[model samples]
Target: MTSNLTDNTLDLDQAITSIKIWDQIRDAAQKSLRSEPVLEKMAHHIVLSSKDMAQGLGRLLSHQQPDTLVSREELEELFSFVAERAPQIITFAAADLEAVCERDPAATDFFVPFLYFKGFHAIQMHRFAYWLWQNGRQDMALFLQNRSSVLYGVDIHPAAKLGKRIVFDHATGIVIGETAVVEDDVSLFHGVTLGGTGKERKDRHPKVRQGAMVGAGSILLGNIEIGHHARVAAGSVVLKDVRAHATAAGSPAKEVRG
Candidate 1:
């Protein structure tokens, strides 16, 4: 009985040491992944934004000094969330940017500027505003909304629903209307307006289909449906439904190609 007890104690000690070693390895990997060079290098500003937002919340809550590290499982869930609903934002910022740079020089020209954009500066700000909005701080949310516009030139209403992987490449002059539904893999170029056609009070503005690319300087007004895999050509003002796998171009845009 004495020998058995000694062996059990030794086993417990070994188990604890093994667990500690695994923990150190896990911490090192997560630290590497969460670094700016790793996370932000791919234009993964959204992931970086979420982490910053979480850190800000941690600070606001007075959780701990330097904040507690998020678990690997939790981090994976966040990345998967971005992958499922608004994948383009993550894909563009993460892997697509590199691929695009090699394939399309124009894409490189457009995306590089947004890498250092002040637009995403409000991502954490919006998180706070969103919390306020949820907690009946409508006025506070609106105030932050105004500040976001003034600072970022990217006006996303405090009440708007934004999914992951939604990239606002060159984010300038981009407006996300109050009732717009932007799905995953939706990519918006510079100066694109997703807005209401008139003074309609309901679900006005546009619904961007998944994997759809809205070209630069395009206006998608009213409750228009931009279909999946559809490309709204540059300078087009689309007021009507664009069919999937089609290209809409020209003023009062017409489908010129599929």
Candidate 2:
């Protein structure tokens, strides 16, 4: 019984530590809503009334629809389905929100990214779409991808694998291919493309390892690997593997001494 109590305490501590930032964000949102009467309806619907992060995010994403192809009800149902089916979606979102607050100087609070940042919105939408893809709902995934591209100007393939703590700064015009894999703590700026050289399919996109920083307007082609902690300079065209901790620049990017 003593051992069970200790284990329970440790589990509770771990869970609280994991959601520390999320709790902070929720508290901040509530305070802000209280002070700003204009935001009462929107804030209450998106955050205050929400039971948890999953429900809050579901409502937020579902409300972004323009009522064309998918109605607000349909969008909400889809988001709720994904959130319930895969709880990891909320986990990734929390990490992502924390990442934006830590990495972007412009981000003042979690509510900023949760409400206004299209880059953050695009990534979360992709998470839902990716869940659909994994569950053999490819058509629905494609539909969400198309909607995300139209709304956010960021086109990430539904099948692409993404890790935690990724910051897509100014995510407009960012395109990631179907087979591309982005590891944790990676930062990508606007106009970055992880693409293939030719029409050949089958494992043809770039693999970006952990802690890499990809600059704006850069194009990385083929099945090349960008090693961990490497930096690719802006407007560079990379065609080869970049060694870990190295800096690659210029067209057909070559390693520059870091």
Best model per TM-score: 2
C-alpha lDDT of all candidate models, in order: 0.56, 0.84
Candidate 2 displacement at residue 81 in angstroms: 1.2
- Candidate 2 overall Cα lDDT vs. reference? 0.84
User: Which stretches of model 2 miss by more than 4 angstroms?
Assistant: 1-19, 34-36
State how far residue 215 of model 2 sits from its true place (Å): 0.3
Which stretches in model 1 have alpha-carbon errors above 4 Å?
1-53, 56-115, 122-131
Steric clash count of candidate 1: 9
